[model samples]
Target: MKAAEPPVPGLRQPGERPAPGPADGVSVPGVATPSSTGSTPSPAGAGIRGKRNAGALLPYLLIAPAFVAIAAVFVWPLIKTVIMSFQDVGRRELWTGDPAPWVGFEQFTNILGDGEFWDVVWRTLLFMVACVVATMGIGLFLAQAMQRMTNWVRLALTGALVAAWSLPLLVATSIFRWFADSDYGVVNMVLTKYLGLDFRGHNWWLDPKQGFLMIGAVVVWGAIPFVAITLYAALTQVPKELEEAAALDGAGAAGVFRYVTWPVIKPVFQMVATLSVIWDFNVFGQVFLMRGNKPEPEYNLLGLYSYEKAFESNSFSQGAAISLITVLLLSGVAVYYLRQLLKIGEVE
Candidate 1:
């Protein structure tokens, strides 16, 4: 080897490999080195792993606060209500420190046996259906009309909708009551003066049909803004390219909506409709205010009926039972929304 090239310092000798530098990764005996294994740096791989773990936990972290709040505000109360529903609670039991005596299923049994409860149930369902139909129909019409509006007009319309939606339930109920009040109401005055139908002193609540019509009108008016705003937003997101293509294919307005728009907005539509059903099914304020708080037996919806039973009639257990039944009845809608949420989660 020619005397090993005079053993040059910091240089490779004959048949002797140069050692790895720190940048290339110095190998420890009997240990796996990153360079030797042709793998990334441990810290880099560890950083990626940490990021993945964080991403996995992010959704739960975001929901944790809300879950805690709902548990305290709704879940605890719900559990207490369930417990109360089984007890024969009254003034004595409520005022006393002692627990109320158990009535088992007696409260539920009595309410089930009462024909008036069934009538209230039927009436609630009817009102909910009518309100949902009218709300959805008018809201959908308004949303569709908005798509064709000029930018300024759309902005003005959106502002109006927001203002309407911002109104408190009591305020909206009061406005509707004033509009349809039996004495000196705008509706009566207008009908008497302009239409000449002589509806000056009509008592709407005398006929349940007419009373529900007015109540349903108020509900629809309040509900429309939310639905219209949601649908309009959904409509805006629909692919203009697809709509144009459908039009080019000789599709009419209805056909374009059926083929291109409906699929895009169906989930939103279903959610809004379900919400309307829940709200109108448990409607109390509008009915209560419209009938001046002393709602007749015929004027009671599920919520008002429950309140009347609990406070006015002092049938606490029965009211609790009715409330529980109401929850059970609407459980289907809850399940539907839950599935929708899960489906959305899966998509994400």
Candidate 2:
């Protein structure tokens, strides 16, 4: 065979491959070129580095002021309240600028041992239950109804819900109080005129049960909007095909809801129910306002009892102790709900 021509330097022969350089790119047939987009750091790297640094620091910077404010506004007072709960803080210590005498757990002991405190606890719990049940019941009903409404009707209903939910606590309290007014109230006017139940000049607050019933009505009214809106949103997540399939499988409305609907919205329902419990358990404003900012002993919830102990009776230590107990009770409630949620999650 004739001698093959010597392969030319710096030029690739036919079917010849180029060599890779030690640097970050492949050498071409005639030249080597460095890669700009390789792993090697570049000027752009400084920008990326800066961005990463900023990304790490930005959250801290944004939250720093909020953390300081919370520490000042809430944490500091909470600490002081905790300290006061262990001491003998009263009007004497408050006004005299003197150190509060340490009573250790005496304040807690006094509060726990009081028969009236138990009464307040039972009453508060019962009211909380009533409001939560009514709120959840009506809210679920409204949400179920919304699914059957026309778009315009649903929109109008949603607007109304928003209006109800947007009412300030003070405004709602005032409205309910006006409704329950003894003489000129609309509720009494309607009952006496239409139903002729002889509710003229009746004081709902005279009986604790009746007073709590009215208070619960106000609480449930305000709360239903939130629960309904939330559950309505949750209900939107349910698969239409699944519901249709369930319906086709000889399931009725209740069966479809129980099998297809409930599982989907159960988490949101649980969350709303728990929130209602917390909100109703700590109810203060409606009760306080309905009774003209001077709720009697019969209407005393934990909040009212604590206020009565601390400010009204000038027993700051006792009030702080009661407040602490309320916190513990709420904590227990939260834990119980959490466990239930977890259990349901496992079961489902």
What TM-score fits each model?
Answer: 0.83, 0.83
Cα lDDT tens digits, model 2, 170-222, are 99988888898888888899999999799999988789888888898889999
Estimate, for each residue in 51-126, the C-alpha lDDT of model 1 and write its tens digit.
9999999999999999999999999989988988999999788777578989899899899999999999999999
Reference-based lDDT, each prediction: 0.88, 0.90
Clashing pairs in 1: none
Steric clashes per prediction? 0, 0
How does model 2 fare in lDDT? 0.90
Q: Which candidate wins on lDDT? A: 2
